[model samples]
Target: MSARPGGWRRRWILLLAFLTPPCRRIVALGSRELDGAAAPWDRWRIRVHRSICTGCRRYLQQLEILREAAHGSTDRPPPTTRLSTESRDRLKRRLRCEPAKS
Candidate 1:
C-alpha cells in the first residue's frame, strides 16, 4: 500500500488519544471533581480530557448546571401566600361562629 501524506500527524493524534483516559472514565472523574471528591491526578486527567473532548466538556457543563440547579432548589425560600383583609376577616368570623357583617 502507498504511504499516506501527514502520517506523522495521524500518529501524533493517535498517541495523544491513547495517553488520555477514555470519555467514560473522564466523565466519571469529572463528576467526582465537581463534587470535590476526586484526587488531584484524576482532576488533571479530566481537565486534559475536557480540553480535547468537546462532548465531555459539554456534558460536564450540563451536569454541573443540573447539580447547581438541584442544590439551588432547596436553598430557595418557600413561596409566600397572602390573604386579603376581607378574606381574613371572613375567615375569622367563620371560625368564631359570628354572623357575617353586611
Candidate 2:
C-alpha cells in the first residue's frame, strides 16, 4: 500500500522536533529570569520557544504557580510550635560547634 497523503508531512514534522532544542532547554531559559540572572538573549530565546511550543508555555505557567506559592508562604506568621529558651540555646550551641551541613 502507498503512504497516506499526510504521513510524509507528519514524518517531516517529527524529524524537525528531533532536530530542534527540547522543552527542558526552553524552561531553563525561562527559569533564569526567576533566579534574577536572565540575559537578554535568554529572554529572546524563551519568547521564541514559547511562541512555537505549547508545552514550554505550560511549564512556565507551573513555575509561576510555584513562585506565587512561595511568596504567599512568606506573608504568613511562623507556626505556633515554639522551642523553649533552654532547648533553643542548646540547639544553637550544638550548631555553633558543628560545621554547617548545607
Candidate 3:
C-alpha cells in the first residue's frame, strides 16, 4: 500500500462514488423520468449519473427510442415492438461491462 493512501483527492473520489447511485438505480430513475413519475431528486441523480456513465447514457437513449415507438403505436395498429438484434446485443454488452455495485 502507498503511504498516502491517495490523500484527500482519493478520499473525495471515494466519497463521491459512494454517494452516486449504481447503474441499476440510475437505470430505474431514467425509466421513471421517461414515465414522468420521477421525483426532482431522482432527476438530479439521473442527470449526474448519466454524465459520467456511457453505458447508462446509451441505455437511456435506447429507452427513449423504445418510448417514442410505444407512443407511436398508440396512434396506429399495435404490432410487436422489439429491439433489433444488434441493439439488443449492444445493450447487453454495455450492461455487462458496467462495474458491479458494492
Candidate 4:
C-alpha cells in the first residue's frame, strides 16, 4: 500500500488523545477531595492544583455549593409551588418528542 498524506498527523493525534486522558485522574482526585475521601497526598496534590488552576478552584467551589444544596443549606428558599402531575406529564412528553441536543 502507498503511504498517505497526513498519516503521521493522524498517528500523533491518536497518541495525544490517549495521553491526555491520564490527566483526568488529577481532576478525579480533586473531585474526591471535595467529597471528603481524599488521602493526605491527594489533598496536597489537589491543593497545589487548585492554587495554580483557576478552573479547578471554580469547580471545587461549585462542588461545595452543590454539596450544601444537597444537604438543604441552599442560599435561597426553594420554590413553594409544585407542578401538577398532568403538567409534568405534558412537559415530559414534549421533551421526549424533541430531538436530542448536542
CA lDDT, candidate 2, residue 55: 88
Q: What is the Cα-based lDDT of residue 51 in candidate 1?
A: 72
Q: How many clashes does the backbone of model 2 have?
A: 0
Off by over 4 Å in 1: 1-12, 75-102
Descending-lDDT candidate ranking: 3, 1, 2, 4
Q: If both were scored by lDDT, which would come out higher, candidate 1 or candidate 2?
A: 1
Clashes of each: 0, 0, 0, 0
Top candidate by TM-score: 1
Model 3: per-residue Cα lDDT over 1-102, one tens digit each:
665855976666566557779999999888889889999988987887776678998999999898889879767753556667999999999999999998
Which of the two candidates, 3 or 4, achieves a greater lDDT against the reference? Answer: 3
2 or 3, which is superior by lDDT? 3
Tens digit of per-residue lDDT, candidate 4, span 28-100 = 8877876679898777766655655567668778878888788884546556656779999999999999999
| Candidate 3 RMSD to the correct structure | 19.8
Q: How far is candidate 2 from the true structure (C-alpha RMSD, Å)?
A: 9.4
Error of 1 at 20 (Å): 1.4
What is the Å distance of residue 26 in model 2 from its true position?
Answer: 1.2
Quickly count the clashes in candidate 1: 0
Winner by lDDT: 3
TM-score of every model?
A: 0.58, 0.52, 0.55, 0.46
For all candidates in order, the CA lDDT equals 0.82, 0.78, 0.83, 0.70
